[model samples]
Target: MSRSRLMSSSSLSVHGLGKRYGEFVALAPTDLEVAAGEFLTLLGPSGSGKTTLLSLIAGLAAPDDGAIRIGGADVTYRPPYERDLGMVFQNYALFPHMTIEDNIAFPLKMRKVKGADAKKRAAEALELVRLPHVAKRFPRELSGGQQQRIALARCLVYRPSIILMDEPLGALDKKLREHMQLEIKRIHRELGTTIVYVTHDQEEAMTMSDRICLMNSGKIEQLGAPGDLYFRPRTVFVADFLGESNLLPAQVDRNEAGTLAVTLDGGAGSGQAIGNGADLAAGAKVTVMVRPQNITVRPAGEGSGRLKGRLTDIMVTGSLTKLYLEALAPGLPQLVAAYPTRTLSDDHSIGDVLELDWQAQDAVAIPAGQ
Candidate 1:
């Protein structure tokens, strides 16, 4: 099906939204636009105000300042019941006294839907989550994954245009959580619902979101697609938070052709700056972040030997190995690289000095204090 066919007719807009608790600011005056059917993830650590922003949108809490619009209609002062939103929580929030059918039909009841029509909607919703045969079961009789699906079905039964999910899969184990990720993607594609999801897990955000709004200290740090945020981070906080990072201080040498050249601090290495384009003057202090998987370890002097460090540790995890290398001089932070376990050289061992290399374009350089 065409994407537009699956998308809602309206978008969610937050205009200068602000919230405060006593002397502490929970959310700064901020504006954001979530396109219809877009899956946007609010990503950050606890206490970062992501939840506070979500609450304001859900009308669970009134914003101290700003207006929220659903498809261009103002809803800032509206009550939760009037906002037309579907919510899924970390806890299943299922009623133990109710059967699966009753739980799914509760929202329709509130909307005054009953009798055959309500039952039909409940059945369709149960089948939407692939639990068509579970209507006769009670919440206590279902597994965690099944109960979570029931919660999802309950949320979908009413067909709200906007869905807000606050760590809905957080209660599941890793394997099941992963499985549900694909399921959620499938559901989202089929329904064309505009989903605003919140999670602290970077991997989950990257896997499921069309765009990620990374938050820090109660503010948005960066907003972009997963690969753009991962490969071309604009700030040090963004670089370190999104994934594994090898951050090294560096000085700009010059811009060569379309690429900028830089000298690594502590004699780490010198290479062309690829995707990062923070304007910097010569000798400006900047930090370059490289992912562990990008760095290659080779026997010292075997290749370019651009930088040499002593192998200090080897951490093996099934198919991959984490190799730690530190500079010969004291005080330099160790470099961590990921290598395929099957291809690791038997000749190399801890205490063996090795040359570490990475494609210049693979590193993202950010200005100091960014």
Candidate 2:
């Protein structure tokens, strides 16, 4: 078998991509650029167009209006086989009748390579996936992880230029999933392949991806590295959906020095200000979102900008304690704080009045009213 060495493309670009089923639009016009050798994961809830984009790129489905380019070549309507892309699915599609050796050699056979060459390539691929010892075993005789590795070996046998993985680890147990996450990351680094992966798990995306394309409502909400998306999300949906947040409604208040002051209103602890003398006159009804870990809890009344709340519940999770507090005001939102166990000297019980304080820079003020 003549092995086709995988070559890296400059980038994969999707322009004006759209997909529709009858009257309903499955995906709106979407544009994305993935750099060569970059691990870009598409993350979203179900029916959010993540899978649609994947299918379109894989040539499994057609785009209503867009062109996909790889290394400056148009591949929008190319057949799957001609696209030179490797695909790994949620289910490991292995042949029960064939041994792991034959299964890994299947792609090379389909491309009309045979006999000694095919066998040699299959052996090499099994070695690449660290499954050389199990080459003679059938799919039914192997563990789930072994079978998955065989599936990956099959994809790599053809040495496709790009690899597309659609929730490939969704079936594994938590421990196995974490282990395979590292395995896949290692394999990707060794092969230096351009990979487009899809998953709904935020932690998985944050752990493995070089950049993440976050989707919502059939469109891309934001595209950035994990830290950027977590700390500097541009929209409310991106902030609220990516992680846990305490979203308090605030309004922009301009002071005499021409600075922006964000005011939260419900009662006393309601008003907070940031960018005191900056030029934000947008008057946008904004939502100030803070992470649970960002809130500092002191006794009752030491901090200057303090809120009064009664401890509603405490959850101890070995390393840290999750505290839930209800504000004294009738309609103010409940606040959640995560404190390291080492941070607290005397453990406070429920119903104790606690003061919650945070620096203005710790929370981000999003645009008014989403």
Candidate 3:
């Protein structure tokens, strides 16, 4: 069967969605949209409401406020079964007694699809997941990754308009989890089914999502393409949560045209960085965020706008090496610089004083606390 025959996609809209449990708010009034065939991930740490939002979308929980529409049809009050959706959970949720083929066909059987048609579609679903040979095996006979694929296959067999996955790859090992991420992306590309996935893994979100909705404290903190949130984060929390960053406290000296000249706190050094579209006036306190990969380390006095620090640690992790520097200035925090392992030379020692600098554009000056 062609990809179109396996699944049909739909758009999703959430309007002022809110949920609460007694005095605790689970989700704030939130609005979101998932385009037809788009993959969006709800990303956050525990208690951040990503799962709460996913539950509301799946019709597993009723919202305290606002409405939900699937493919522009109101489904806020509908039961989970009434919503044309498929769900894959963290656990495989496969019945131990059922064969792989039977597991895949179970949803079809519920929908009254029987006999040869159910069997054939189940086979097709297994083939789509690249595990057609495992048809006769029970759930216990398959590997963790294989069982995950089977769970996904079961969802696809029903051709739900939208698919909801709540940390479906959470149970796998690191290597297998990464492999499954690519596999799921490939399947999404082929099937074009709208997917609203929830996970707390930032790397997973960066790898699989077309757009990521980062939730915090029962509210969305940021929503955008992974790069957008990484490179141009609006707040300090966004910068700190998505990846490692060197957030230096600074006081703005002046706004030179569009660039802002700032003096690092603790008398580290003076440098310039681009503001995040905020009106950063002279004397205002701000934090300049520089990604570890953006900082360049060189022999002392060899770089411009330099901050002198002692090389305290060198961690080599195969493809990349991380250098930790303790700033010589009393109040400055330690900084980390990441470089490809091949680009680093053995000339530098752990106790050596080094100069660290970065391009102005590579650093973002966000107003303190924002």
Candidate 4:
């Protein structure tokens, strides 16, 4: 699908992209269509090919096979210079010898944009990053954030439609890294430029991107809005990697009315079939996945289904409290519960016995996938 009609000059579409180093695959077959003015993040761990994919689109590295279209023009074989896209590297890569002004003006000068216009563009670039007064200083004179801004300014000076960022904020301290995330997001909104950002930080991707493309190995694991990925992960890997989860083994024994009768074990003793109009055959095995925050803890009471457990650990993490429990029964798995700290009546200590419960709606059965 071409984004030409909907995207401005900054929109991009990629199809069947793959990269290989001899027999070793760096990236598998992939397709991604980024809307104009959208902030899409390529999120994955190291060796997941997120950087390789970004390089392929930026024309920094060629793909073994695929097609790349930017602003409706086929540029699969175009060199990086001809792609007309701005790129920011992890190291900033600012020219040490050039003044801030000259570094920002390099792209314009290379394109034969001369004299008064090039200098003016450079100055405006500096102003956009709020460092206009430092134009005369070289890269070494600026702080890490300033240098990064200058690199960003250099990339934006020529007004490229697409901007590819590879861990541009990775070098900064935590506070500064967070600050730059907002700045980058604000810049993208203001320019309405298509941005393809790469990062291994889940929080960063969730906080800054309009959508996230989660990759594993050399292929895409899942792609969706951040919220969708958070709430409805499709696989065990997706469930475990995106955030904390408690996976319980469940077996479907029967379907009555709209609910399923799932026999759950390993701290999932009170398992009940839960879903809207779900129908499944008996004797089917599925994994019941639940997030920690969804489970509630209380003292043992009269209930048809509840597990007895000893509080093995209590971790008070400011906003929330994490409770790790060891089930008394052998067939039950160890139970983990996370809830708002304020919800607990008494401060829980190690060795305290507690009851764990949850609504069926809070859990989902993940059928095996091919």
Candidate 5:
């Protein structure tokens, strides 16, 4: 039991999975697959169906439709215990009455594993979490971070084919949460266990996930590597939900080359829709989504595609500075830009005319919000 007693590389797949609570659709029909050892994060705002999807995969709740497969075996109808998967709950469901070692060994004992083997495996699991000496400590006696490590180690004891985490680090403070993120990454690298992590924290998902599946309204919004989803979101919701975006409504028209031209309305220097934009019908209304970090600020008349505006506010935080400006385009949204303090444009106070512009390629155009 102290040796490699792990399950074979497993790929978890859900086909047409859906769930309901009375008349409310908790989860819409969903199809997803996790390759063996891949760290896929389910990211979305609260009530976006991420938790429902995770619970379905873990067999904590029965699915109303579709099938689930693990390690090439259909397990949709199987109970949680029979699915051979480990789940780390958000509340750190550790036994308050047990010692750390006993808590880690609980799973093995439930499975009727031999005493000697279970103890050896529990020790190995404790060591894997770098907490070998804490085995004798009671759960209530340990720090919150220590208790979390114990919960993780307990999940690791059985070496299930897949591990599902539902906001496992949500309770920890900022510093400890960051530390645990690295720890989880290290364990995943060492054990190569397939992980399906659910969290509403975008930064956390970006830090640990190999890829992210963004959910919205009980359906998958976008699924891809973090950068792909952030940089090139396919839908308006995807663009707005994944990160901060300056969504400027504009008119779109196609050129002779079948390219979309965007016309953003800013007061004096507002650009008109010409045949020079993304792919959209002529005269169609679209929204230009740009990240605050992508915007370059300058004194009016200094940059191309500049939106002349008055500096409304500025914030200087440690190595970064954020600038907020009133819109130059009569109906344009307020402009926001964030960048390194070392890269600040000339010193300009409030009432300074500022222009905000970004490379055309940096801005994504999608239909106006629904």
Candidate 6:
């Protein structure tokens, strides 16, 4: 119930941790290390193995291969209750018949804490969640958001070594979900508890994680900070999956002075771009990745870079405006640019010819095959 009781977190390590269901691989052999008090999110689409990895870590499922260690102790075959880990699922998973205080104290009771000690600890957990006033209310009497806070309070009451959350905010509405995201983040920061969260929402992962482990086809596709995964993706899938990208087909012309010069296919555009430290030989096929926000739109012949297109559509969404342009060159896909709504001139309209340009440092040229 004290601050020290809540702050005793631990590190987690997964070495070649894998899971399989007959011929289908739910999670490929993977190696990962989460530092003590670090917030890491397992992020990917439904079948990408994020949930499977979380399940394996929570000891809900046994790994077919590899080992899992928490705080330097092997927990690969430990049961869920014996792993010293707490979990928050999509559902609140609270006992409807129990009072909020009792629900939060349930874990301590199971651990054989006396009635007086359990009651005091439950009060402290509710205060930690800023919901001490709702201790007497039952789960059914509270709003969805309040119930979720209670669930988290329950998880914290036991003072587990690590906390694992599987889309804990998935059941809430958008506004409430966003609010709870901040609440959970605040609690994590205050408790300094090492947390492994699983979510399919990229924005959620980006907002909450110190590092994102992006999985694809039961394997880790990329692992890094949100900005690194967004701006310096290692593969085409990482580029396309994390955000909106203009993937221009190109052929490498040369690799000189840390820059890779490339010629765009269909003569759409040509420019120098940064590579991912790999030597790309001349005439090699590649894809130039440029984020929508990095593209600048200007009058023809006004910008330094050369790529001309006709504006096809304009969309305004409150603070940001999106411009869709179709290149004049054949075989090139349409390009999109997003800018602050106030920065765009009202004179620009659809069907207007415009020039597109981006800094070389802002673009990356990746191998075509990844």
Top candidate when judged by lDDT against the true structure: 3
TM-score of each: 0.95, 0.90, 0.97, 0.88, 0.91, 0.96
lDDT of candidate 1? 0.86
Per-residue alpha-carbon lDDT of model 5 for 1-370, expressed as tens digits? 2224643458999999999999999899999989999999999999899999998888889999999999889999999988889889779888888889999999999999999999998998988889999889888898888888899999989888899999999999999999999999988888888999999999999899999999998999889999987887777788778777787787765544543556675433433322222456767777777888988888777887446668989888768788888885578777788888875554979888877777766777776653
lDDT of each: 0.86, 0.82, 0.92, 0.81, 0.83, 0.90
lDDT of 4 by residue, 1-370 (tens): 1233212456799899999999889999899999978899999999999999999998988888889999889999999989878889888888899988999999889999987999987887777778889999988999999899999999988888888999999999989999899888877766677899999998899999999999999999889999777766766677778878877777776766646667776544656535322345677776667788987777666344455678998887878888898877666667788977785454777898787666766776665441
Which sections of candidate 2 miss by over 4 Å? 1-10, 254-260, 268-279, 342-346
The digit string of per-residue lDDT tens for model 6 on 1-370 reads 4558765789999999999999999999999999989999999988999999999999989999999999999999989988899999889999989999999999999999999989988998999889999989888889999999999999999898799999999999999999999999999888899999999888898899999999999999999999999999889999989978998889999888768888889887688789965678899898889998898889887875477889999988879898899989888888888888885467678899888888889999888888
Descending-TM-score candidate ranking: 3, 6, 1, 5, 2, 4
Task: Give the poorly placed runs of model 3, Cα more than 4 Å off.
Answer: 343-345
What does each candidate score in C-alpha RMSD?
2.1, 3.3, 1.5, 4.1, 3.0, 1.6
Worst 10 residues of 1 by lDDT: 1-10
Between candidates 2 and 6, the one scoring higher on lDDT is 6
Higher-ranked by TM-score: 2 or 3: 3
After superposing candidate 5 on the true structure, give the runs of residues whose Cα lies further than 4 Å from its correct spot: 1-7, 253-260, 266-279, 343-346
TM-score of 1: 0.95
Please give the lDDT score at residue 325 for candidate 4: 87
Q: Could you tell me which 10 consecutive residues in candidate 4 have the lowest summed lDDT?
A: 1-10
lDDT of 2: 0.82
lDDT of each residue in 1-370, candidate 1, tens digit only: 3434323535999988999999999999988899988999999999888999999999999999999999889999999888889999999999899999999999899899867999988888887889999899999999999999999989988888899999999999999999899999999988889999999999999999999999988789898999999999999889989988888878888866536678877766676666366667677787878899998788988856666789888888778888888876444577888877875455679899888788878887788889
Clash totals for all candidate models: 1, 4, 0, 5, 7, 0
Give the per-residue lDDT digits (tens) of candidate 2, residues 230-283. 876777788778887777777777533433356665754544434312245656
Which of the predicted structures, 3 or 5, would earn the higher lDDT when compared with the native? 3
How do the residues 149-220 of candidate 3 rate in per-residue lDDT, one tens digit apiece?
999999999899999999999989999999999999999999999999999899999999999999999999
Residue 34, candidate 5: C-alpha displacement in angstroms = 1.2
Best candidate, TM-score-wise?
A: 3
Cα deviation at 316, candidate 6, in Å, is 1.4
